[model samples]
Target: MTTSILTSFIIIISFIVKRIQADCQNNTLTETTFVYRRVCYFANWAAKRYDNISRLTPEDIDPFLCTHINFAFAKVLESLIIAPYEEDDLKGWTANSKGMYERILKLKETNPDLRVLLSVGGWTHASRGFNEVSKTAANIKNFVKNSVKFLRENKFDGLDLDWEYPGAKDQGAEPHSKTGYTKLVKKLSRVFKREAERTGQEKLLLTCATAAARHRIEAGYEVEEVCKYFDFVSVMTYDYHGSWDGKTGHNSPLYAMRNERKKFREWNINSSMLVWEELGCPKEKLNIGLSAYGRAFSLFGETGMSNGKPVTKKKSSIGIKASAAEAGKYTREAGVLAYYEICELLQNNPSNRVFWHQQMSVPYVSSKTLWIGFDNIRSVTLKMQFLKEHGYGGVIIWSLDLDDKTGTVCNEGPFPIFNAAKRELLILPDHLINKDKKCSDDNITITIEHLHSKMTKIKQSKNSK
Candidate 1:
């Protein structure tokens, strides 16, 4: 009887605490004050194999929004909608149809300031769609006209084109894609800007997700002409070196360690910035890229890799899931590879060769199995600080879905990385106030007045309900 009574008391206390917290949240002026903080998460609905928009609840999208998070781009690459003469080319078409626009509109209604945009073209897919869509004046006109109608009908804030490349022509694609690409963007901008005026709608933002490798841009797209059509470009700076590169290095090196001196001399952030700036694009229009996840690699087996550890045993399998455990035996790992919230190497032993790179601001693990590289909170913070120093527009996350939804990674939620970037870069007026420092009573009075106004609004809402 005594235990039951204690339990009842605890439950009552919990209820009361919850009620107080809700009341405070409703009346807090900070919660009500609306400000447009510019940060965008690239959400790929069709590309994801498991996480689908239909399975997602309103809660799934809520954490991504607040006064600070003003924008989200639901990537609807048109290439996915088209058949690419491949078997899986039709794989995602059904799961990702035109209904994405409606789902995004629902998202916008939930949060007044939150806006959604559809992206077209992506790397490794639809290389030909760009050429097919832009090769002729008629095709360009149709794409632009239909896109304007689609945006208006669906109420999207803008559109982002993410064509991987135009000239390099990977796989079995066409050449002169760069030439046609420039004309296509020029044509689209002309129509989009004009339609906004005729309809009296607010300005529509035009942006692109571009390649980061120096050679890719110089060979593929005409950077100068492409910048003219876009308000800003998101440089995919990650994936610089991966298992595919056949070498061990950070996936996205901030300073290009392999060729740092040469990078400084010719191709680097400064040169990339110059390319866009010279094309008449404003500096503020450029946004860098960040990746929430990391890449893993496996090294050779039967090579006396078990240096001196027991867990350094080779895994009997491949893929990211087995990388950590399989790497346990070959204890001679060089870099740290982060998987979800667990690092197998770190858990087994901290003194292992695999460790964080302080200078490049990334993590990597070198093991007998293979050398792998990835990112962590420290690297993310460094990237954020870099953005602030450069005063570039903002940062773009490669994805929003892969983050651990349970909020376990880095002691923050899946989107914490992006949220940190906003706080450090945007400099909101509220955050500027030093909460620790004492302020005059006059400022306190003003804050109280605002809180009182919010209280009134809450009371009005309660009475209506």
Candidate 2:
């Protein structure tokens, strides 16, 4: 009897606490202040990485490190509805336990300012889902309804549509998909705005991962119109040049090599940004994509490779004959190496040369058999400065897992690349960037653990009764 009474008392107390918390949250989160966004993309599959240090779960994240976290990829179904791509993405990841969605949302407890968005579609999902969703007005309406419900039910702050290219024919995009794409975005924006007004909450943020190549952008987007609906456009500035070129090239050079052909010159960040501007997107609504990895090449005529690590003792600049480098040990992707792996190569080879491309404002590794182009702390700092100089909105890292996440490899510290970028990005004044931060988040700290504990106890009490 005493135990039952104690349980009842606990339940009442929890109920009261919840009501108070709700009131605080409802009144405290007013959209009136602003801060520059440091958007980090969380790759869900990183949990399966081969080793402890290489693997990352939500527990490994520093919630305060970024202003926004985009959970990389949920899928778009053939029925023109949204769905979780990974089986573990939905609730009950492992027999009634919280899944990736719950784990990531838990971050908000630590950082009330942090907004997490579910990113839908990726390269693998491609444009098919997008093309299908844009097939009709009713399809788009149903999609927006389902999408909004999903995001809200899951407590996501927004949705990031990552349609690779809306109108690229090679990607199997339906004709006039570009126009349809604009219509889709417009509808989402309108619905999100209306919902926010109805509920007295902030509107859900809408962003997109867009193509940086001039031709891609021109063909895929009705730039000025689309920009009006998106909170920001994350231009894919990396992968400007990779192994497919069959020659040495910078993956994301800040600028073109001096006096290059106009055709090739358009490949760099500087030119890409110019093209976006020419197409009518404002500089302030753009966030350039930052990569935490580099592209590597297998230089021709070099027998210097051992277990995927480059064995060459020489370095060459652009135009060196080469193909994609063997996949890095952990990343296991041909032509690509994580920042950590790049660091490992440098650390193992004391004689390896680091070339600072002054004009391109980036760095590359030189060796006889392989060449790698990636960003270091110095390079990242330069890129951040470039964002500020050009008045771009912010930076979006491709994935958090690719960085030296645990400080074991780089020895510079955990998340060295991220920290470097953060320091530079914070240089942007807060008041100038976002004005929706007026409410004090300090008063309300809602965490799933607390609620889950209460629920568990309530169940036990009922069973005892």
Candidate 3:
């Protein structure tokens, strides 16, 4: 009896090992099958011109964007954030006090199926607007009422609030208040959601952009409350390491490890997805962030160290810089630079590695005298796999404007990472899918409940239109 039990245990162990290998292999196949959803980031009329002047019009927008694209946001200002006397403070942008209704109407007419939303707040504009609007019931109601009118007049399908952060204090903003922000979001959700249903419009899409780091959430955002109000949230997961830190690394990495001895953690995709999930957000409503531009940095000099020390008389301390377009030369001089337009650097020596934190799945690179860490197609694909495995809502890029256009890699333009995702993941609508005998699992239902739930919402919104 004893001999038989031991033999059976050995067989079971072998079977488990085989199964683990098979699972890993299957995951590999899935990773290759990544398809990124599309989002176009247009902040205001100025951003809109970025596309038009680039000769990218409605017809051109279709190729790069999925049916659903986000019209970045409309900003509202409080006296505290922007001093009235400051020259060119948030200049050359549409104002909430202006007639955005007309602008929205124009957008609606252009792409009826396109989900037009009013994204509120941005990086530099994270004024105390969120805090003020979210603090009181009266303020929340007033904002919601005006927003609904804007939606109705402009024919926007929903509202996208681009609150750069709720708790993190901005340059012009006050400190964080965990409960105040949550209450505000909750009130907005209740009002907007209720109104949408009452009016028989497809459920209004409530969404926000959340910070990628876990600390941000803990510091200010009540993730659970925010998620409750939002249909989904985009994780601004890029910028893991850049000039901000004196190191170089990939902005976005798939399986990044901080230390050599630890297991790799896919921060850009898997970890970001898990961060929200662990925060009690439904995986279906979690979206990942991507960047079209790459970060660039240079190596200064070698010192006492021969191979890796400062040699030249150049400053021992590190300095950071980004490419600048000399006003009139965007397309010609930009050289398709990402964060910093260092086309000149790409001309000399284009590549270097910062270090990949195996435990975090992040990588950084340095060149010349600058260090940059950002995501590329390879890193994006890894993150997409995490999205598929975790069944997150979808993926989002920082701004569609930065997509690679020149045949940098094959015929695929700047949006290669996202394009690859669309082909593999089936984020493209069925109508858009090229019906061919190419796909092996063509007939399989991609719907796994939360998968493409946003698509369903979009369709319902379209039907309402």
Candidate 4:
């Protein structure tokens, strides 16, 4: 009886092992010698999101999914230094408990190559502390000192500055703020270098997330100077259109529509990146920013046209006039929906149809009353191809948490966008990836859950033997 049971266990274990090995051997990631960067942003506020399943804590993050994860929107304090926006960012919330920041860093235990950064400022934080830091040499010095201390203390790998735009006087930016911003960037770069040499540690990566709009780029960035100083310039290529345009448009159109004119012609991913190159940002140092959320718009009563033809008698997203759609269930923002929220809407409503914009190279959902512009596996694959063909530095996601962490909502398995990314972009090296369960296919993602389960079972089988 013991021999029979042991044989059965070996057979079961062998089957599972064979499946993993087959999947791993077939992985395409190992074939490529070229290294690509995958920088993902983490939205800490998502911790407070209503739906527990949708809420993304550090625990939910797959460290192997990205080379660098920037914790979003650390505040610039009144003292001109950086600090966490959330209380959970620090430890001691409970007895001997780690905080969100440490929890995120601990992911490095699984992926030693993973870099965690503290991203200061966002659209909401705007230009608050940036201008202050740029005010004078003294202010800049104090800010840098504290920033280094905080980052080293917290064990972060680097910093990502997401100051909206530096020269937008309309947004309360001081005159000549671009120069000021440049000074700040240069200082951080210098200090970071010196600090690394002083401590005999790896140099902290210094990146800046900037505007996508051509005009904003020109106004807010002394591109040549800024690019020379920073490690990477992350140009956010989304939000090209929304309710702000008072009309329907794709959020991250790959190319400008033929119908677009004037400044609108330049509002596209390709056009913006071209502008980045034009402004002297080396393609190798340029990382295009993509979003995991779709900008939603409500139908404002019109059957828009396509190719000069009426877009059916029914409401459609083809350049239709629009207002704001209702807020997402978890994101709770009317003008946008998380990818998972969009998936929920698509799944719940069978009548809702998905349409592709060949010209824009993105997908959109058009229901009777709403339109949403978003990227999925198909489009993301195309974008990664574009990245490779253009020889750009890499791709950076707006927020990692927004992707569907649950397989049930999208029915595409968890983190489908990321899964597609792993296949299409760079593959994880063997050191970072589980050697026992190597994989590079979209369907054969070797997630943390997969590795942990296998490890547990293998240990149990050994005990059985």
Each candidate: what lDDT?
0.54, 0.85, 0.55, 0.81
Could you arrange the candidates by TM-score from highest to lowest?
2, 4, 3, 1
What lDDT tens digits, residue by residue, belong to model 3 across residues 1-465?
Answer: 444454566566556656655675676564533333445564343334443333322233443345456665566554212111122223324444234334433554665655655566777667556667665667666777766775665556666666666667543435645676677677768877788779887766677777886666777677776787787788887765454444334566654444422222444555766777887887777787877665454444322123454444222112233332222233343212442233333445645334444444444444444454555555666666676766776777766545543435324554565565555566543533443223333222232223345446655676786
Candidate 2 global TM-score:
0.82
- The top-ranked prediction according to lDDT is 2
Q: Pick the TM-score winner.
A: 2
Model 3 spans with C-alpha error above 4 angstroms: 1-37, 45-59, 79-113, 170-176, 260-268, 302-336, 339-371, 405-411, 427-465
Q: In model 4, what lDDT does residue 21 have?
A: 62
Q: RMSD of each candidate?
A: 16.3, 16.6, 15.6, 14.8
Clash count (model 4, backbone only): 1
3 against 4, candidate with superior TM-score: 4
lDDT of 4 by residue, 1-465 (tens): 544565576567557767876766777445534467888888887777777766888888887989889888699876787878888788647888888888889999999989999899888887787787888888888998899999999999999988887998777778767888888889999999999999999998899888988878889889998899888888899998887776677888887777776868988889899999998999989988788889898874446444456554433355676677888878888888888888888888986678988777889987767788888888888888888778788888977778988767788887888767767876443443453444444433444346456667766887887
lDDT of 2 by residue, 342-414 (tens): 9998999975578898889999988766788888899999989898888888889988999998898889898
Each candidate: how many clashes?
22, 10, 51, 1
lDDT tens readout by residue for model 1, 1-465: 444454566566556656655665555544443232344553434233343421222246553343222123323324323222322322324665434345445666667767566666566554646767766788777777777776666566777777777675563336767787788778877887888788898767677777765667767667666777876777776766555543344566565344345543323343455555555555566777766555555554523233342333423211222222232122222232334423444446554345665545566665555555656566666776676566566677755543443455345654565555555654534543443332344554565566556556666776786
Give TM-scores for every candidate, taking all chains together and pairing residue i with residue i: 0.65, 0.82, 0.65, 0.81
Candidate 2 global lDDT: 0.85
